[model samples]
Target: MKIKEYRTQFINALTPIYDAGEAESFFYLILEEKKQLKRIDLALHPDLAFSEEEIAVWNSILEQLQQEIPIQYLLGKTSFYGLDFEVNENVLIPRPETEELVDWIIKDTATPRNNQGLKILDIGTGSGCIAISLAKNISNAQVFAIDVSEKALATAKKNAQINAVNVTFINQNILETEDLQQQFDIIVSNPPYVRNLEKEEIKKNVLDNEPHLALFVEDNNALIFYKKIAELAQKNLVPNGQLYFEINQYLGKEMVELLEKMNFATIELRKDIYGNDRMTRGSVQ
Candidate 1:
């Protein structure tokens, strides 16, 4: 089938589940990944045809898309923080807001104001995004990451190796853990802070496809992970060491208050591109 005709069919098939714009974008993304064909290539050569075998494969992906399966999982790989990562059901897909959090850390560390050779730890490092990005960008810093799921840890380890950045990956549940054996100059987490009561606010593509263990907490105890991580940071952070979190937008004030209650000085709350209160940071005295 000609490329343009194939795209029309793909969009028509997906329009029931996704809007025309999304379906059209998905088609282009799949074409780029599968055939290495960009929009320009197609525009210049509209007569490009798919082989019978390619048609069969496209049909398989189209079926999954119609069911609302994430295209990233179908591709088995994704770009995060300008690095490629292998993702599956075991880990949560990295978010753009998390990338902003990483950029914030890198900027602060690279400034002449901060000392060199800083040590950092990333709790709940799904896909190793935060830890690996810090190690790659900061250059002089030592980075470590921890996660509860062994499967998730395995994925994170693979990402660290692929990025050619050395990060110590550990397997441990943050909630049940009490302390880190070594102190860090910075401790960060994009922990599971979505309350179960906020289910209606989440899109079906996320709630149905992503790993719930990495995405949610019980409604009554919504701050469970944040509290535990803060307690550990109090014990593990060196003097003036900073703690950071990619927070739930709805709980920005609550998160800042929680850190203040723990006596974290120089507290700051920041928003993401969407203007939601998305991250919080503070220094330990």
Candidate 2:
């Protein structure tokens, strides 16, 4: 069928689950990935048709999309911080909010005031998005990433290779670790901060499809990862070194308090484009 006709069908199939605009965007995204054709290309060549096999392949993806699987997983990759990252069910899909956290880090590291050869560690790095992006953006950065899950770390290593950035990958659970052997100029983590009580607030697509281990914490200990990572940072961070996090929006005050109690200096919380408290930074004095 013609491109526009298929586009209409694709949107109709997904509108029940996603909004009209989102559904339309999904169609164009899949089109570019599967057929290498842009929206304007389809519009210019309205007669461009999908072959029988192509239609079958697209129908399979549509079925998965209807099942609430994320489009990023369907495409097997996603764009983060202006770079493409490979993703799977093993790791949480990188979000725009996380991109903002990355932007904050990049902006800091790229400044002329920052020293060269800055040592950075990304705790619980999934898909190596943050670590890779930092290494790619800050040419003199010495970056390392760690994750508990072997599967997730494997995927992250592959992503680092794909992105053409050198990021040291380590396999270890942050909670169980006692010390970081080496000091770092920065320690950043977007760890499992979502409380169990907040599961109901998560979208069906995210809750059902994303890796829960990378997404949640016990409600009673919602700041579990933050506390652990902060404790590590106290010893591992060089004097005046920075710590950053992609924080849970509802826990902004709690996060600030936690950092303050830990003696993290100059604590700052920043909002994302949507005006949610999505990023935080502090210096270790």
Candidate 3:
């Protein structure tokens, strides 16, 4: 069958569940991945055909998409911070807002005070996105990442290798550790900050498919991970070391307050592209 004709059927099948724009996007994403054909290629040719075997594979993916499985997991890969990462049920798919948090760190460390050797750590580094991105961008950074789930760490280690960056992956729960045991110039995390009450706010695709261990916190103690990581930062951060977090949009005021009470200097709360308070930074004085 002509690929154009199949594209129409594909979009129509998903338009009931996803919007027209999203369904169209899924069509093109699949087209590029499966056929190595971009949207323009299909548009210009208007005669590309899908073999019966290819149709079977696409139909399988379409069925899963209808079931609300994330396209990243369906594709088994995603792009973040200009690098590729393999994602699965074991890790949360990295988001664009997290990229903003990473950009902030990259710019901040572009000209470090001591550039010879810089140490950095990422807490709850689910996919190792932040750690690997920083290590890839910053030439002198020695990056380390920690996660409680060994399975998550395995994926992260693979990502580090795939990105050709060295990030020491550690399998330890940050909440259970007494000391970081070493000092770092920077510490960053995009830990579980979604409150239970906010589950309704999450889209069905994410809530149903993403790992909850990397997504949720008790509503009453929404800052549990932040507070614990901040305490550890107090002991582990070097003098004037910086800390960064991708936080829940609703809890910006509370986050700034938490860092303030902990005596963090130069605290800055920044909004993401959507104008939501999505990232915060504090420096140890």
Candidate 4:
């Protein structure tokens, strides 16, 4: 059938599960990925027909979409921080907010002669997005990432390879680790900060499909990972070494206070594109 003709059916198939806008966007993204056809190509050539086999393949994918599967998982790849990463059920798909966090790290570390060969660690580096991006952007930095899930680290390692960046991947439970064996000039994380109570606030696509190990925390101790990481940062970071986090917008003030009580200096919180206080940074004195 003509690709343009499929658009209506595509929207209809997904409308019950996703909104019109989201369904339409998925259709376009799939068309581009599968057929190498742009939106304008569909618009300008409404009669461009799909082969019977192509239609069948699209039908199967559409059924998955109707069942609420994420488009990124369906494609098995996603773009983040200007790099393409392979993702699956094991790793959370990198988000634009996290891209902002990566940009923040890159800009902060790009100063001339500033820790040019410094060691850096990215905690909870699901899909190795932050670690790989940093290594790709900062020419002289040594990067490493830690995750408790071996499967997640596998995906992250693949991403580093695909991005042509060298990043050491380690599997360890950060909360249980007593100390970092080696000091780092920078430590960054986008750890699980969503409280159990706030699960209702998360979109169904996220709460249903994304890995919970990478997304949640106990409501009573929502800052558990941050606290532990801060303790390690105190002992592991060299003088004036930096610590960065992509934070929970709702807990910005608490995070700032936590860092302050830890005696972190030069604490700063910044808003993301949505104007939420979504990232924070501080330096160990």
Candidate 5:
């Protein structure tokens, strides 16, 4: 069948599960990934057809999308911070807000002074997005990342290589440690800050398909990872070292308060493009 003709069928199949915009986006995403055809190409060649086998594969992906599987996972890859990252069930897909957090870091550190071998660590570096982005951008940064899941670390390591960034990946649970055993000029984490109670706020695609261990915390101790990582930063950060986090939007005040009590200097809470308090930065005096 002609590719343009299939567009209507594709959107109709998914519109019940996803909104028209989202369904349309998914149709294009699949078209690009599966058929190597861009929207303009399909538009120009309106009669360009999909082979029976290609149609079958697209139908399979449509079924998974209806089941709420993430398109990034369906493609087995995603773009983050202008680099490609492979993702799977083991890792949380990197979000745009996290890109903003990385941008904040890159802006502050992309200078001649910071090119002198700055040490950076990314805690719970699920897809190694933050660390790899920093390493890729800053050029002279010594990037290290830790994750509790060995499977996730493996994927992150592959991503680091794919992005051609030199990041040291470690398999260790940050919560179980007392000392980072090294000092860093910067420490960043986009750790699990979503409380179980906030599951209702999540889209069905995220709640059902994304890795929960990377997304959620106990409702009673919503700040557990933040608290632990902050304490570690207090001890492990060099004097005047900076710390950054992509935080849960609902806990902005509490996050600033926690950092203040921890004696972090010049704490800053910044909103994402969505105007939610999505990032925080603090520094050791």
Candidate 6:
């Protein structure tokens, strides 16, 4: 069958569940991954064909997409911060807001800090996206990442290697640790900040497929991870060390207050591309 014809069927099958634009995007993503054909290739050729075997594979993926499985997981990989990562049920797929958070850190660390080597840690580093991205971008950074789930850590370790960055992966629950045991120039996390009440706000694809351990918190204590990590930062951050978080959009004011009460100096809350309060930074005094 002609690829373009199959593309129409594919988009139509998904348009009932996803919007036309999103369905079209999914079609092209699959096209690129499966056939090594870009949208331009299809447009120019207009005669590319899909073998029966290829259509069989695509039909399987389409069935899963109809079931609301995230395309990233269906593809078993995703691109984040210009690097590719393997994602599965074990980890939350990296989001654009998290990309903004990473950009902020990269730009903030552009200048040399007194010619000193930098140590950085990422807590709850599910896919090691933030840690590996930073280590890949920053030449002098020694990066370490921590996560509680062994499966998640395994994926993160593979991502670090895939990205060719030396990020030390640790298997530990940050909530249970007393001390970080070492100082770092920067610490970052995108820990579970989604309140139980916010579940309805999550899309079906994410809520049903992504790891809840990386996404939710109790409503009454939505800042549980932030508060705990902030306390650890107070002890583990070097003098003037910086801390960064990708936070829930609705809890920016509370996040600032938490950092303020913890005596984190120079606290700043920033919005993502969508202008939602999505990231916060604080420096140790």
Question: Tens digits of per-residue lDDT for model 3 on 1-285?
Answer: 999999889999999999999999989888888778899998799988999999999999999999999999998899999999999999999999999999998888777565447899999999899999999998888999999999999999999889899899999999999999999999999999999999999999999989999999999999999999999999999999999999999999999999999999999999999999999999998
lDDT of 4 by residue, 48-124 (tens): 99999999999999988877778999999999987899999999989999999889888887787884797999999
lDDT of 1: 0.91
What TM-score does candidate 2 get on C-alpha atoms? 0.97
How much is the lDDT of residue 94 in candidate 4? 93
lDDT of 1 by residue, 13-123 (tens): 999889999999889889999999999999999899999899999999999998888998998888888999989989998999999999998888877557388899999
What is the Å distance of residue 235 in model 5 from its true position?
1.2
Candidate 5's TM-score reads 0.98
Candidate lDDT values, in order: 0.91, 0.93, 0.93, 0.93, 0.92, 0.93
- 133 in model 3: Cα distance from truth in Å? 0.3
C-alpha RMSD for every candidate: 1.1, 1.0, 1.0, 1.3, 0.9, 1.0
TM-score, predicted candidate 6 vs. hidden true structure: 0.98
Off by over 4 Å in 3: 112-115
Tell me model 6's lDDT, rounded to 2 decimals.
0.93
Clashing pairs in 4: none
Q: For model 3, give the 10-residue run with minimal summed lDDT.
A: 108-117
> lDDT of candidate 5?
0.92
What are the per-residue Cα lDDT tens digits for candidate 2 across 177-236? Answer: 999999999999999988889889999999999999999999899999999999999999
- Score residue 169 of candidate 6 by CA lDDT: 89
- Candidate 3: clashing pairs of residues: none
